[model samples]
Target: MAQPTLGIMTLYLSEHSGVEERSYFRKVIAQAEKLGLRAVVFTPVDVDAKNKRIHAYVYDTETGRWSRSWTPFPHLIYDRCRYQDSERFRKFRRFRATYTRLVYLNRPISNKWGMHQFLATSARIRPHLPHTRVYSEHADLTAFMRGRRLVYLKPINGTGGRGILRIERQSGGHYLVQGRDRNRRIVAPKLVSAKQLPLQLAAWNVKDRYLIQQGIPSKLPDGRVHDFRLLIQKNGSGEWEVTGCAGRVGPKMSITSNLHGGGQAVPMTELLRRRFASEEKIEEIRKAVYSLGYAVATEVEGRFGRLCELGIDIAIDPDGHPWLLELNPKPAREVFARIGEKETYEKAISRPLEYALWLYKQHYGTSSSRRRSGAGKSAASSTR
Candidate 1:
């Protein structure tokens, strides 16, 4: 009998075939082996459409190394490809269209504005959403900022805190602006007159590519902005559960607290304690965050199909009210390891593999019986 296989699909980051998350994929592959499942990593560019096979990267436990091999499509695919502004991403889209019958562990969710509109439809989820609008022109920004003190202009498709502008209205009719460029470099804070504000942002071309969101006040006494990242994943039983939450403190003068943009990760409890006065209030906030995480995950999976996990960015105001800021389908679990929560980090890596095994069993039965019943043949045929 053969173990069910899971394919971890990713994209090359460069023309030289540079792959992001190589170390993380290695951990996933290693854990898959321990869970009685075979795993391989591949990208759309590696697929041989005519041959109905893939050139995949496989890990050898004994040798402790990675090597390439050609193999049939696996019983399930865990898509980890993030947005890339390259030919590689186009190839991925074509691959997905061609292999529509393949069983995928997750599907892509909407972008910032689209997700905001979708989640707004839910009465249960709407209260947590901040006021947001599409940036059509300078007027849209001005109108949305009418009564707001702080507003964020974010690229709808942007990641890692790239191309984010923080605008705050100051006393005496002046505006303060700061941001991160497309490369995630901090743009120095500048103050401009109300009439000159539009020219300051003229180079951003925010008319169509950006969203104007009311920013929640997240600045600490030391002037470093912070937020929380809550990771929710489907367990072995195929139910959503909070794996762990971590607090992120942005570098000085940075508006966004993204780890990729020079932010520090802290334990959730520790960060909350620093903000909240009482243990009772901290526990209350924790429970609310968990509830919000579960509700958001359920709403997303229901709308976007089966999703194995979500990295939800949440903001807790001074009043301890939780707000939904953003969602990442392909979230990094390194925050737990960064905060030194070893157990949570291991569980974060293993839970998805366990869910994959459970899903295989649900569809194909036990490994021995699957071999006798020719379930492997069925998987290959259907997927291809």
Candidate 2:
């Protein structure tokens, strides 16, 4: 019997073939080998389109090294490609379009604004979402700021808290603006008047590519902003389950609590304990947060097709109400490891592989009779 193959699709971070999650891919490939599966990592640029083969990076367990090999596309693909602003990303788009017949474990979801609108359609999930609108003009921002004391301006397709601005309405007709630039550099807080607010943000070009969201109050006693990241993944039985949840605390003077932007990862319970005095209240919020995680993942997969996992960013208000902040399709699992949750971190890394094995069996049959089947074709067509 032959082992099923899984291709981990990713994009080179640099012209020199730098991959962002190299170590992580090594871990995934190593795990796949142990589970009777063969895995390879490749980007679109490495594909030999004419030959229908990929020049992929494969892990050698015995030698503990990576080597290149020419191999056919795997039985399934795990798309780990993140957004890149270069020719590599353009190649990725073409690859996805040209290879529609290939089976993928997960497909891309909509951006922040598009996703927010779609989630808004679900009556059960709508209340958990923060009010958000696409930024088009000064009037749009003013309209959204009418009653809200704090608002956030975020790039529609931004990740890792890049290009996010925080606006706070002051008592004396003044507004304070602060954020991280596109480079993830912190922009110091500035006080501006009502008339000067638009001018301050002119450089961001917020009209078409940004979203204005109602800011949830997440300040702690030490003045740092904090939020929770809940990870949900499909188990071996192909059921949605919460793997774990961790809390993120922003550094001083930072508006967003992104690990890439100098934030600290903490245990969810530990952070919740700091905010709520009663254990009962903390437990209630915990339950609500997990429930929201399940609901959001289920709804998203129903609309966007099959998904292996999702990292949901959630905010808990002073009243202990959970609010959905954002959804990350290609979320990093380092947060769990950073917080010293060894068991959860290991589960986070292996759950997707387990799901992959389950999917392989369902699609390709048992090891004795494993072969290319219509399940891949049907799944691919459905995504299209």
Candidate 3:
């Protein structure tokens, strides 16, 4: 019998810039091989629906190397392509529409606003979300800021905490606008009022295609703003499970806790203990975060589709309340590495492979065949 194959797809893969990411694919390839599955790495350009084949770099476990070859599309696909290029995105759509039968671990959710709207359908997940609204008119911005002291204006399709602005209401009824500039440096605070908001916002030249969300005051003992990044993945049983989590402390005077924004990783439990005096309250908040993370993973997929994993960002307010900041389909494993949690990082890397194996067996009926074959036949086949 031919060994089952698993395909990992990304965008414009090259050995030069793919140095860090290639190590991850190699690890998954090795682990998948252990489960009697072959793995290959490819890009959208490598796919050829016209010929029913993909020219991919297949990982050979025998010699531990990658070699390019043409083969049929694997039964399972792990879509990691961000579709940064508009043209590449159109190609992905054509391929996906044709290969509708191939199993996908996680379907990419591009627009943050779209994901929020889907998640808002569930009452259970709605409260955990910060109040969010589309930004069109300056009137809406002023009205939202009127109720909350601080609100964030974020791009609808932004990632890595880029293009985010923190608008805060200051004393004497003035407003302060500060954020990371396009050059990735912290911008100077600008003062404005309700009357000046329109002109000031127009000066920035980006009031369209964004969202205004109420900001939660999640601060450390040292007064640095931070948020939690909790990793959740599906297990071998195909159930949602919390894999790993860490505290992302933002840079001084910055708005986001993104690693790209000069943020540092720290122990989440220790941070909670330092922020909250009572040990019992700290434990309570920890449990809540995990529960909320699991809920997000499940509810998001319930609305969207099957997701192999998610990185859920959470904010803990001063009152010990946890809010869902955002959920990431492509959660970076580096955060766990920074926090010195090697075990959790390895687990985070391994769970997707395990889930893929589970999906393979479920879709192919391998488990049931073994069950019906009994122990003797199963052992006999394994040795063969």
What TM-score goes with each of the models?
0.94, 0.95, 0.88
Off by over 4 Å in 2: 366-384
lDDT ranking of the models: 2, 1, 3
Clashing pairs in 1: none
Q: In model 3, where is the ten-residue run with the lowest total lDDT?
A: 375-384
Each prediction's whole-model lDDT (CA):
0.89, 0.89, 0.79
Better of 1 and 3 by TM-score: 1
By summed lDDT, the worst window of 10 consecutive residues in model 2 runs over 367-376
**RMSD (CA, Å), each prediction:** 3.9, 2.8, 5.4
Give the per-residue lDDT digits (tens) of candidate 3, residues 332-362.
7778989999899888878888888777665
TM-score of 1: 0.94
TM-score order of candidates, top first: 2, 1, 3
**In model 3, which residue pairs have backbone atoms overlapping below 3 Å?**
none
- Please give the TM-score that candidate 2 achieves against the real structure: 0.95
